[model samples]
Target: MIKQLPISVSGSRKYDVRSQFAALCYRIRKNKIQILLITSRGTRRWIVPKGWPMHGLTPAQTAAQEAWEEAGVRGQSDGRCLGIYSYSKETDENGHFPCLGMIFAVEVSSIADEYPEAGERERRWVSRKKAAKMVDEPELARILLDFDPRRPI
Candidate 1:
């Protein structure tokens, strides 16, 4: 479910703030950690796999599912969320809504050759530093930069 915050007015209009779940899918490749990112279907902007909450799943599970559908990632999602980042989501009705994304760490085991959204999006594995720079969200980028699976969040 997309939980919207109390409407807030900026100028002459009001907007809702929703919360989403995202997966920070990563793998240890050649002894170095790499993050997987996918291009947004509409804008082709780099973003982590994310979606609204699922009824029968935990937040981590929801994030993991999104990773599977969006990036073809099979992995173990951490029990705890890594962090939260906020962005403005563009609506189909030509409006913008604020969204807070809870990011979960997913340690990827394998990537599938076929998955949902395969043709609609492009996925790539990149160095954390590069991934941090490629993403548009500042808070999400900061999370990527500070990521260390061995350390506590």
Candidate 2:
């Protein structure tokens, strides 16, 4: 499993950054690469689904797992690394992450019928251009651009 770095989480206590990670995933449908965007509970902040890591999983595997849990979609991954980004993690209404987050590339393969975790979230398939514009984070928007069909990650 990837390392989880301890950091100040805004909600109730310190959170481990290294122990958790985030991921962005894509699926090609109708000749366009569609990115999956999610809405989190409470704050309704538009972001990708991500969470703590599990044992015996690679960072990419962890990312793929997060997609399944958070977005209800199953995906494979590209050998090409889309690279990492950082965010502060928190467990509160502000919805700000209180720790630095690392990002990875995951390829969408299938979406399950059931949502096993928090249903406080919903997901949608959108164009890379629209997906990039949906988030406020520049680095995250840039990550979406990297997934452009014409732009190789």
lDDT of 1 by residue, 1-153 (tens): 233332222342223326778999998878888999999999999999998776567788889999999999889875678899999888786577788999999999988999998999999999999999999999999999888787754
lDDT of candidate 2 at residue 93, scale 0 to 100: 46
lDDT of 1: 0.85
Reference-based lDDT, residue 102, model 1:
97
| Reference-based lDDT, each prediction | 0.85, 0.69
| Cα-based lDDT at residue 21, candidate 1 | 85
The weakest ten consecutive residues by lDDT in model 2 span 5-14
TM-score of 2: 0.76
Best by lDDT: 1
Global Cα RMSD, each model: 6.4, 5.3
lDDT of 2 by residue, 45-75 (tens): 7788777655556666777788888888887
